[model samples]
Target chain A: MNDAQAPIVPAVEVLAFDIFGTVVDWHGSIVRELGRRYPQVDGDAFALAWRAGYKPAMVRVMSGELGWTLIDDLHRMILDAILPQFGLERLGEEERRELNRVWHRLDPWPDAVAGLQRLKRKYLLCTLSNGNLGLLTRMAKRAGLPWDCVLSAEVFRAYKPDPATYLGVARVFDVPPDRVMLVAAHHDDLAAARACGLRTAYVVRPLEFGPAHPKDVAPQAGNDLHSRDLLHLADLLDC
Target chain B: MNDAQAPIVPAVEVLAFDIFGTVVDWHGSIVRELGRRYPQVDGDAFALAWRAGYKPAMVRVMSGELGWTLIDDLHRMILDAILPQFGLERLGEEERRELNRVWHRLDPWPDAVAGLQRLKRKYLLCTLSNGNLGLLTRMAKRAGLPWDCVLSAEVFRAYKPDPATYLGVARVFDVPPDRVMLVAAHHDDLAAARACGLRTAYVVRPLEFGPAHPKDVAPQAGNDLHSRDLLHLADLLDC
Candidate 1:
């Protein structure tokens, strides 16, 4: 909960990360890119609206209302629905497609690259995000995030909060679930991983929803560790 | 077939690689490790024997004679079977497990890392191996192989030469099959990839089976490109 009371580091062999808001600043990235491309658009509101559709879209697929769909396709569906509301329905096919790939090019938080590099020296690092493999791979390449392995819900055919997604990391490494740590900014994602028996490291990303909506960064009850950001996480883990 | 008559490079967005014999020297690595660990044993014969069981083991899983098994498990099965013949039946469980993981610590060919770094600058690079994700990920991490993504038969629930495995690479990147190139030392693998409409680059690994059994590094028909090794392939691609 605090530096003075930091828990003893668990013997975690792999650190599985959540990508969208945890590793990359999706809200800030979308807002910046949208404003640059379409000056007249309310990028802040547009960014929020686009992301607001994400959970429900995944729910649709999970509920079988939609067949198995990739996050890229889901993003496009959300984009198409919100375009007219943002007065951008006139965007061309190529532009809309490129815009959708912005998710693949989202920038990392300031401390992310450095922290991951430090952590990489000590443990196997991977992504356990709901983002598809292609998106995570391209994003890591673009952002210079040095991931030892790029994993996604696509690999498991199930999204976050599913026991399969969390346990899949342990299965991949042939380790017990407790030997894998879920490093995430969201409590729900960590809770799901915890429920699956993984260690959890809570990373505070206060501006994950952008400055207009600050997220609570308070330490939660079940997490094994808490840190201000990935840098602090690396330090806390003694990386 | 030769540099004087090298085929024009195909327009590929992703370079998917075959791991075991192509990128890393499993035979050599095992031979060296076994010789070091068991001075009384004929390491060369032991290495070949262990490898000889690989295909048959996969066939059992593929034919549903056994449930879907990871390479790590397959390797252990082979090790357990061959240990008696090699007088290693006395090996403890922990030792057998560690020996089985030698597959994960195989040494990369000298040019692999450098050539991959060069190619990484131009294309999305990933492993499309029949090796399970855990083995491939550990091998890449230990050997300093910079893979953008680690894909495996485990992810597809299918093994090499399966159309699903070949096509899965293209599907992962949302690219047309021809826009994905399969680079491998094995003719059968390239042929399988080619049949799935993917481009093929034949990388010669003459020492894959050890100097006592040097493989013929001939450029076969239907392969889009051929090279002495990964470095030469990088050169042919202007990487």
Candidate 2:
């Protein structure tokens, strides 16, 4: 192995998992949920646009153009904006409100629960998600994610890729950044975590965008560990 | 029943618990942990002085005499001031720091885990404590206290009996005050909760102050439900 990719390993105490695409199959859940309500509209496109709106919406908050808004509200804002474009604006306020809660009931990837159970035995497990506290809490209840603590952008009033969201996990547990490793699917997420001095574990979620879009399977530069899934990462960590 | 004694139970969806004396035996844990390190000192009296400093320290933050300080830091402040009084200032800084974490490992009341588990079946359970997020998270892990989310005064930057703490739980879930219940042992805590329109459940912890002080077991004026312990409250809630 080259010196640049020597794999920086440390005695990790806390494993903060990025929840949405990393643990739960958000695309699958959103597509399925949107399909149920809007049969006339293309569910895949609807789900894609809804999620695509997320980062830009959060950027408004990060840039201080907007106040600290919960991801639930952000999801709703995106949903409201796109529904009329997709010819699904007939949905009432209450229906749209209920549909936005699909984020709260996203199904966990099959291996997530067992892998978390294994990793949890060895290290403290927490959700360091962009999802708000209410969304994360309801998701934990629905999917039984077994998080020791459900932390969110809501807690720090900042979204992911922000330094506060990554470092906030360490601050919550009073642990150093090095001891708090962020296990995530996306290279950008891990990159942000690494920049914040946290160790990074990259798990490939090929089905993150559903069976058709098998993206981000290969390892990127600077990840401490790269594996096929959360279970594979757990095995790599000797959990 | 008179108007003052009337029951005001609304259909509740969430139950927020007070941890220190209500859910966990802080005095017992503090006395035991202190006794191990400082056998020469009166552990009971030391524990009392340390706890007695808690509200005053929190008051400093609330009154803006001090800025937003976590209970962990507040506890350390009290510990440092009283250590010389108890003649245990000889303990090194590292040892003192580790000992301060005893608050993080306090033993839950015998019925807390089971009762919380029972309550979890029916209602969303959370911790609404003066303790910091880190302290509460560690205590939950050690004691197997199953909280849907562990919240604290640190979250709102305000301590208990403050309207912010009680109303904060409702805000987290986006529920009305009547749909959220405050499960605490102290009447002052419940009274504050009631004034904010939250339903109140009183759980009596008989040995909260140890055997010599069997205190505050009687039902108060405004509690919606009063019970012998958390198990009894779970029974009362039909969870």
Q: Write the per-residue lDDT of candidate 2 for residues A1-239, one digit (tens) a residue.
A: 12332245647889999998899999999888877777777777877888899899989999999988889898999999998999878889999999999999999999999889988887888999999888899999989888888888888877889899889988989988999999998999999999999999888888787777778578887888886777777777777
Query: After best superposition, candidate 2 residue B154: deviation in angstroms?
Result: 1.5
Residue B79 displacement in candidate 2 (angstroms) = 0.3
TM-score for each model: 0.97, 0.96
Cα distance off (Å), candidate 2, residue B16 = 0.4
The weakest ten consecutive residues by lDDT in model 2 chain B span B1-10
Tell me how far the alpha carbon of residue A152 in candidate 1 is from the true structure, in angstroms, after superposition. Answer: 0.6
Give the CA lDDT, 0 to 100, for residue A168 in model 2: 90
DockQ of each: 0.84, 0.78
lDDT (CA) for every model shown? 0.91, 0.87
DockQ of 2: 0.78
What's the distance in Å from true for residue B174, model 1?
0.5
Could you tell me how far off, in angstroms, the CA of residue A158 lies in candidate 1 after the best superposition?
0.8
* C-alpha RMSD by candidate, in order: 1.9, 3.2
Off by over 4 Å in 2: A1-8, B1-10
